[model samples]
Target: MSRKKYILIFFVIILLCLSLVSYSNTTIGRVLRFGPANANDYLEFPYHEISTTSTYFKFGEANLENIVKSRFYDVTYGNNQKVGDLDQFLEDTDTTSFIVIYKDNIIYEKYYNNYNRESIVTSFSISKSFTSALIGIAIDEGYIKSVYDPITDYLPELKKRDPRFSNIKIIDLLHMSSGVSYKEPPDDIYTYFAPDLRKLALEKTQVVEDPGNSFLYNNYNPLFLGMIIERSTGKTVSEYLEEKIWKPIGMEFDGSWSIDANDFEKMESGINCRAIDFAKFGRLYLRKGNWNGKQIISTGWSVASTAPYGPENNEYYPNIPIFKEYPGYYSLMWWGIRRDDKNYDFYAAGNHGQYIYVSPEKNLIIVRNGISYGKGMESEDMSWWPIIFYQFANQFPSE
Candidate 1:
């Protein structure tokens, strides 16, 4: 070896070490460590378990005589029409679990890629819907005064830091219009992998615009909501969920919620549960928050949470229609699509193709969990899943 070459190599090693030391505790460091988020992330992170009750609610099985062995739907591309079946499409699209329930009966259920009834998949952003439900429950139980209450009521530290934060209401958070200054890649990665979420949420969140000015799809909204739920109920978000919804609904299996290093629930995402159990949540909303005649969540809140808000009220991208001809909407963390017949079908969607789609007009619920949001479709067309669900729902009679 040459002396000058050896010295150059040593300098490179020192530079690399300095870079690692500089970025170790930053969002960039976490992203480099964990990589991109995926469906099975619960296995890689620390989480708190949510247990189910002794009595479980079971769905009626469809009669073998009426069971669908093969199903097909039509698809077209560039003037060519092709026939696509449910099973093949799901398999090709990297779907892990797919379930269709009608009138409280399991009509169609399929698991692919080594996933089965017992496998657990992370809920991703679908956890936001669960957070919204907990907030409603807190209000119903008097732990929260009202949706109109300023968020500062529960998180007064924000007001102490910036008085403008007092103008942000709980409803603004629910609507994803809190005006919290957040940009993707940076803000998102920080919230997802930050070891101490409460500190990041309080210290990093800043009011960039008025509270109710417009919809911005801020991840910080749910973080603040989680903190509010914790403060108001005097319990962790996971504890509140267990007492209010998990045990009451009689989940078939124990689920888990991912937590930061400080043990705070990741309210923006990170719920892990079986696909069948996830379907139960859809069924609960399908029955208008009535779980077998038990009013778990208020009907008013149920309707308000899923129903569409006028486009004039901060209904922007992703909430808006993917295609101009069809209509779409968002309300309280749930996504909605207005059918041509003037009826609405709403869903809870997450990153990487996790969904719980509900069609009230047809009395149907479809649950989908996937690995990569499928490979064949363009990125912008990801919302097309609900349309496929709508086509599937149309095959059934309206109840």
Candidate 2:
């Protein structure tokens, strides 16, 4: 009976028939596989079937772009169980693209299911706010100095493959507090088509806790700040986001930015613009980083990236909706919450119910992409989306 144990039981029945046809999540097997219960079926699949299983960067010529429309209005509010009716929360959160930009037109736009306006989706960690706005334009062009250096001083291969991320700073991985050791299960095969999310962040991440004391949602802290912005700006990260913010903030199209199987750059959720180039990066941080006037980025790094650093400015309470009542903070990569008259709001959140919601003192801008299914929640826990965009940005008039 031994012909080399019958060829090792016929290669364990060919590895159990390739793990029973490799992918599942019902509904006719999620157009055939990709975990996390259909990974929010990612805007209903098709970016060339996740670009033939991932490896990206595009960001090509938007060629002096910007030409948006749809200044449609009429957002009269009323009911309140955390604000409702934006077409019943865009048909209960399968929203494809919703936009609203106040002080510069397009005050309400829509496009769903069959998705439109040149549909380029998949910006899951909202590209960690575009790799923390390219490390705040690589620390305002000095090419990485501040943010208290030491991300192994520009990835010295993370001090030879993770030496407790060798003193991990760069504002503690832009405040998500790089304790590294990755974990975001509910099926985290969600690393933008992870056949290899940068070799599991350089072989299964480490330093179990101790990078500027805590706040762990570490997507390898912008995949090590996109290898310190491509080793301090030689280029790549779609050529420094198309030469510092997509051809000088006129982005109208041609965007992409996902990569893993070796070409690295999936910096904590690869980008894929559109939806008015994510509302022109929420109107370049709602005007603070100027665009048309060209100051680009550096209204003091967009007010130190949506202000309120570390623990709600040290009072504590954050970890992305952890235990709720968010007086939030976790800066430089954006996401601050505050407001009870204290005023503060900033966002760029992604993964199903993708958003860019910025509302600098009411000079609003809200862009929301979609494909939110069960597990990767947020349509703000099923259609409350930041209290219906802060009650529709307090129904206008902050002229």
> What total of clashing residue pairs does each candidate reach?
0, 0
Give, for candidate 1, the lowest lDDT window spanning 10 residues. Answer: 75-84
Question: Scored by CA lDDT, what does every candidate get?
Answer: 0.83, 0.65
Clashing pairs in 2: none
- Please write out the lDDT profile of model 1 over residues 35-87, one tens digit for every residue: 78988689867899899999898988785223343333564321243336657
- Candidate 2 least-lDDT 10 residues: 63-72
TM-score attained by model 1 = 0.91
Best lDDT goes to which candidate? Answer: 1
List per-candidate RMSD values in Å.
Answer: 2.8, 19.6
lDDT tens digits, residues 1-399, model 2? 989999999999987765665554332233235445222333443331111213222222221112222111233222333223455546565778877766666746778778888777777877788788878878888989888877877776657875777787888888777776666662244444555554555566677777766666666677667777877888767777877777776665667665554566667666676778778777788788887677878899888888766453342334334226455565777876766564677887766667888878887777887777312233332324554566567655554
